[model samples]
Target: MGGLSSEENASSKSTSILLQIVEHSDGSVSRPFVPISAPSDDRPDATVLSKDVPLNPTHNTWLRIYRPSVLPLATKLPVVIYFHGGGFVVFSAASTFYHGLCEAMTGAISALVVSLEYRLAPEHRLPAAYEDAVETVLWIQSQARDPAAGEPWLVRHGDFSRCFLMGSSSGANMAYHAGLLATALELLPLQLLGLILHQPYFGGVERTPSEIRSEDDPILPLQANDTLWRLALPKGAERDHEFCNPVVAVPPELRHLPRCLVKGCEGDPLVDRQREFVRMLEREGASVVARVDQGGFHSVELLDPIRADSLFSEVRRFICNDL
Candidate 1:
């Protein structure tokens, strides 16, 4: 809850210099650059099946599935359906860095990981992304029930009985809403475990202390966030509208839906809001685990490869423990 002071800010400035040096070092060049390839229907290991499958008729909505190689030998694993962060305006599942992260998560948790590719904004507009997310989950559930009906992807890797919803940033927003909708309609299968939100963008009526303090964050500027929310929500509606704010959107009846693992970054502007939402969830007696990392920025977990391993480790542990 403490804000970074002037002295801490100065230290961060110095750290940035060292970061630049390390980024440019020869050792960094030797690291493999992950390529963002289209989700394919292929098995990397005898027991593991990985594939890209379309979720919608338009074929615009799709997801990449990764099932662990040791699945059959191990206990029935939990499934994590993940949505990537992109400010709801940019990025795709083909992003090499994120794809690699998903690949790593599959190995880390030994669970099935589905990286959802939902529609982006300014083109698809508000609600389209959320609708796509809801449909994708439903489609995934159906596929799990009858693998034959789905593409070769699910037939090879999906285990629907242990399913959870997860996302980062705007994608996190979608996952949050999808969970709410599932609870509201009682449509979600009993296997739907919980939710994991990483630096979710939940716009509110007022700025939190972190938002005001980190208005000038190097990675995610507050103004940019304001802009993204303005474009992502329904036209002319308040940013804190029930749909935009999960804390408000979640109904009392849906309170018992599932456990949630909320991750936040100390240096991110949305940290305070994220914390506030977690507090609200806990107050409602929901099973919640909030992990706030120090000296981290928005999307830092994905942007920094050096940190990705640690981040993935924590996430994998959460998934395994909660499942």
Candidate 2:
């Protein structure tokens, strides 16, 4: 296996590894509530707050906040509104994977991180997750303005003027569209720092040469990618919805939208599509930095802490450079 070709190695490893990781977790902790750890000098301080703010009062949507601990007397830290991956159907704030990543991000960027637990599909479906994302942003803005909310980190540490939208995989798709909708509505008051898209899945198009080439990549197989997208998109709708696929849906006028840091895996099926997105963003006059890590698979950073730190280092540099 060590001497095998990249495609052969990936195909053999993807299923067994994914099954082992996802199956054993079952997403349940033994306690009803677990105390979050404080950020140390070595690790960013983080805490989880659960709130019942409604997305649609009728529909009754809410979100949980994963706020990184702030430096004492620190003012106006950057804010990262993050969405978790998991193909839009599995995983939640409870996952150790999410908790650790959010903490690391807080420490790396010195930003107040807001992780949205949006409703998933096929129960929620298509525009639902996107809508929730928009609402979450609006809610953050509202909370920031309210003095009665009394100086929470979002208001204290958050610099609404310097907000960064970030997401991994399916969450990246949501973040991309939410930014578009924000630009369209003229509701984006913050200085759009940049977008951090990690292994973004833009949906299966007519399979790019890379997709065909890496068909059996270890982390994300072709069939699994197709199945996740099918569940995420609208019933009978084309995969190229303006909300789903930024390459087609993104408008020419919105070209100067924001800076972008697109991270892709050489072994992942979505590598080509991510590269295409980076090209489109660059063409639109937006500053873009695209990095393709050799021999990496989809969300490999999340699965391995060492890799996650390397990825986070790049993200920190991007955020701090702008700050």
Q: Each prediction's Cα lDDT score?
A: 0.70, 0.67
- The residue-by-residue lDDT of candidate 2 on 197-311, one tens digit each, is 8888785456676666544556666555555566667777766766556777568646655777888878777888898888888777887888898877777877777778877
Model 1, range 1-323, lDDT digits (tens) per residue? 34344454444422221122111332121112335765534545434446777788584788787776555653455778888876676667767767777877778767778888888765666688878878877777776656666655454655566678888887787788788777765443436778888888886766678776754567665555555666566778876787667676657755766878888878887887798789888888888888888877888877787667776777777766743
* Candidate with the greatest TM-score versus the true structure: 1
The residue ranges of model 2 lying beyond 4 angstroms of the native Cα positions read 1-60, 186-189
Q: Provide TM-scores for the models.
A: 0.80, 0.79
| Residue clash pairs of candidate 1 | 40-51
lDDT of 1: 0.70
What value does the lDDT take at residue 275 in candidate 2? 88
- State in Å the error of residue 87, model 2: 1.7
lDDT of the structure predicted as candidate 2: 0.67
- RMSD values for the candidates in order, in angstroms, are 7.8, 6.5
True-structure Cα RMSD, model 1: 7.8
